[model samples]
Target: MKLINTEEAVGHVLCHDLTQIIKDVKKVTVFKKGHIVKEEDIPVLLSIGKDHLYIWEKQEGMLHENEAAEILYGICKGKYIRPSDVREGKIELIAKEDGLLKIDVEKLHMINSLGEMMIATRHSNFPVKKGDVLAGTRIIPLVIEKKKMDEAVKLAENKALIEIMPFKKKKAGIVTTGNEVFYGRIKDAFGPVIRKKLEEYDVEILGQKILNDDPEAISQAIRNFISEGAELIICTGGMSVDPDDTTPTAIGNVGARIVSYGAPVLPGAMFLLAYCNDEIPILGLPGCVMYAKRTIFDLVLPRIMADDKITQEDLASLGHGGLCLSCNICTFPNCGFGK
Candidate 1:
């Protein structure tokens, strides 16, 4: 950094914040750090100080903070994500539409591992709306080493470290299992619960069927829904380990590849995930989902709607934040249930 006359400061970057104060009226920053002084800005600088200004001197192997922030933004940017204007060497990535947020945790760790730069993001695989700040990036200093920024860029090459997958418009089919519901011995509560959750996304219930605890009938119903253009199939009830529970067997009978039959989550441990023909997802929800305000289904449903393939590892990792507090008000997604 070097001191120069306000007139000569033009074209140079401000090294510190310039404050303008007025008695009880206002106290505001005239020009912030990293702002490139323009000819038009010289007068403002003179009005604030009237003499010399501290400005950053361009040097080899070094970059201004604003430039470093732009580099960081470019590295992590992906489809359906927009970046905010740089301010004080920081830039925020914003969602362009309502969708599910996906973060490459390994790549994010790799980038942050390189010293002097940082990127902080919201939790991965969670729902986000338009204008929400998904992530923020900045350098640790007023100026950073060019080589360090280059190394960070290289780590993020060929793929975005963060992305938002918009929810797809889908036609969903519902299957309510259990002889009690089919035989009218008890009221069916699962269908309404599933439908209420589906309403939060871009999904429409194409049709619904009530079936007894017959695997053959359940299997045939699943196939029929797929044939009738249902993009998502949800089979509620009979997901437990009881002798009569047969949702998992029914899903397998229909030739769907079961990703997982159970998860390390309370209130929804018996949740089953299967993909029909490697395309549509068929979920077998446990009875706990009918009563619990939040469950593993709430955690994984957004990812499914976004068309994200949930792996066994992904489900396994959820155990870290899988247990719901079951708060009276139930502030899910915002709570620690699925972080």
Candidate 2:
């Protein structure tokens, strides 16, 4: 690129965007790339403190900032994501639809490790809305070495480093187990709470059953739902170690593979997770979920809807950000309840 004083730059084509920023007011591009500078434009350029300008001059084995940013965008673009037009030496990746965001962190780190380039993305394996900015890529300088960008492309290896998995609508079955609720001594509140949460994801409740504290009865109800084409099963109440609590044992008796019977999260520590036939998932929720605004269930439900299997290690990792502050105005998911 050729650098010339603004006084001598009239009639020269701009090699990059000229940005003007006003504190707390606005930031705008005064001269676009390839813009032919006119005598009248010199005052505007000088107002923005640009005494010198870079005019496009191609050099072998070097890349301009916009060119480098396009290469960076190619490395991270994947299914269900769209790239925005390059602007100000940067490109943004936006979600094409509302879905779950997934990032290959290892590859992402490798790409960022290469000097003169960067990729910043939202937390992976979380829900994202349509039009949300999932990631952004840019060249750190006005120009970069072609070799450096080539290294980033080699790390990406022509594969997508980021993707969004669309959530699938699934039929759900709920089993509410508690003697007091079954006998009508107290109203059954678990079913309604489960229904409300499921509704957020457009899940259809196939059926619900309120059973006494009988492990056999709970097990039978689970099998019945599966036979009725229920893709997801939720068993609430009776998950604790009390004498009457038998939801966990009942889930096992139904031949479901229990991924975890407990979690490290507060307000939902007694949570249980199991999969039947390695296809259908069964959750044993404790009583706390009925009252708590957010719990471990909020963390796992999205993955389940996306058909992403949750492993034992996945549940174990929740301990890091499991505790909820239970603020007076709970802003869960936005707050750090299950980050």
Which one is best on lDDT? 2
Clashing pairs in 1: none
* lDDT tens per residue, model 1, 1-339: 687888887788787567888999998778888789899997887887758987888889999888999999999999999889787688999999999999999999999999899999999999999999999999888788999998998888769999999999999999989999999999999888988999999888988899999999999999999989999999999999999998899999999999998899987889899999999999999989999888888999999999999888888888898888888897777778877
Worst 10 residues of 2 by lDDT: 330-339
Q: Tell me model 1's lDDT, rounded to 2 decimals.
A: 0.90
Residue 124 local lDDT, model 2: 79
User: In model 2, which regions exceed 4 Å deviation?
Assistant: none
* Model 1: residues with Cα > 4 Å off, grouped in runs: 3-13, 16-28, 33-53
Clashing pairs in 2: none
